[model samples]
Target: MVMNKALLAAVALATTMIIMMARPSVQESVYITNHLTKRVLIVHCRSTDTDLGAHAVAVGASFHWNFRENIFGGTFFWCKLAVEDKRIYFLAYDEYVETFGTWFVCDDGVYGTPASRPAFLKAAWTRP
Candidate 1:
């Protein structure tokens, strides 16, 4: 009876460990879209002092990044967008330790100003 109880306890512990290991870790994703009429948008994305490179998105196009495998420990990211001969910069910062999902939109011809900020969009509006 004692041996059976010991085996049961060991099985329970192993099962708990397996469950914990199988659980997925927290991750983050960002989506950027260009909603301009006749202008091309260039985007640069970076996090935690790492440069994730740049992209040129045409009107009505978009760019997306998933940080599931490469988790960023910081709570913020920096980005810049170029419109024609002008450039616009912005930063996405959150007080939360981990940002699950967020998105930005470059609408019309409003960006490329010194005081410009990317238009924050709801998760539902993330898709192009």
Candidate 2:
């Protein structure tokens, strides 16, 4: 009986590890930074049909968000920034790619132009 219990326990442990390894990982994130010297940035992030809401990021501050692909096999996010009562908008779309991982938004003192691109950091860490 003791030997049988040990074998069963080993099998269960092996099965659990295999299942964990075979599962698809979800690691996605969006990072937005306000690089303005004095202006506060009010950002609105949303999908095509759903409104995810808005966030206020102070100067030199950053915002990070984690998201998954939509049920339609793609993900689209539009961001609008309000600075000094002026509104500027940008869009990030991912259809073939799995995740965006990280992005950066910076103001270069150019009106109506906010520099946006992927970050230099590594991809987002995965979770079980």
Candidate 3:
């Protein structure tokens, strides 16, 4: 009886660990779509810990990245999208809350997806 109880407890612990390890999903990602009329989009993104570098996205293409949120919280990513001299900025992700968005729309300028409904930062470019 003692041996049986020990085996049962070991089995239970293994099951619990397996269930925790098999969680459906914990990773998160962001997608950036270019909706520009006819221009290539220059995209660059960064976080407190990493820079995604610059990418030239075709008029109808997209760029994306996947990452786990900071374990200690306070994960964030921001991006810049430029078309010719026009540019805009938006947060790609925010861990603390609904602070930023994961889906972005790049038309004449950049914006978080309509579902996000966040105020925007658009810049009209000129020689500086």
TM-score of every candidate relative to the true structure: 0.54, 0.56, 0.64
lDDT of 3 by residue, 5-99 (tens): 88999999998878766654468878887777877888899999899999998877889988886654578888887777666676677776554
* Alpha-carbon runs more than 4 Å astray in model 1: 1-24, 68-73, 93-104, 107-128
Q: Write the per-residue lDDT of candidate 2 for residues 1-128, one digit (tens) a residue.
A: 25688899999999887876665556556667776677777778887776768888887787767765553355677777667656566554455744343444445321222237434432222222
Pick by TM-score: which candidate is best? 3
Q: Rank the candidates by TM-score, best first.
A: 3, 2, 1
What is the descending lDDT order? 3, 2, 1
What is the TM-score of candidate 2?
0.56
Model 3 steric clash pairs: none
Off by over 4 Å in 3: 1-25, 99-108, 114-128
Q: lDDT tens digits, residues 65-126, model 1?
A: 76543322235667776766666555643424433244445452322222244443332212
Worst 10 residues of 3 by lDDT: 119-128
Candidate 3 residue-wise lDDT at 113? 45
Displacement of residue 117 (Cα, Å) in model 3 is 9.1
Native RMSD of candidate 3 (Å): 6.8
Error of 2 at 7 (Å): 39
> Between 1 and 2, whose lDDT is larger?
2
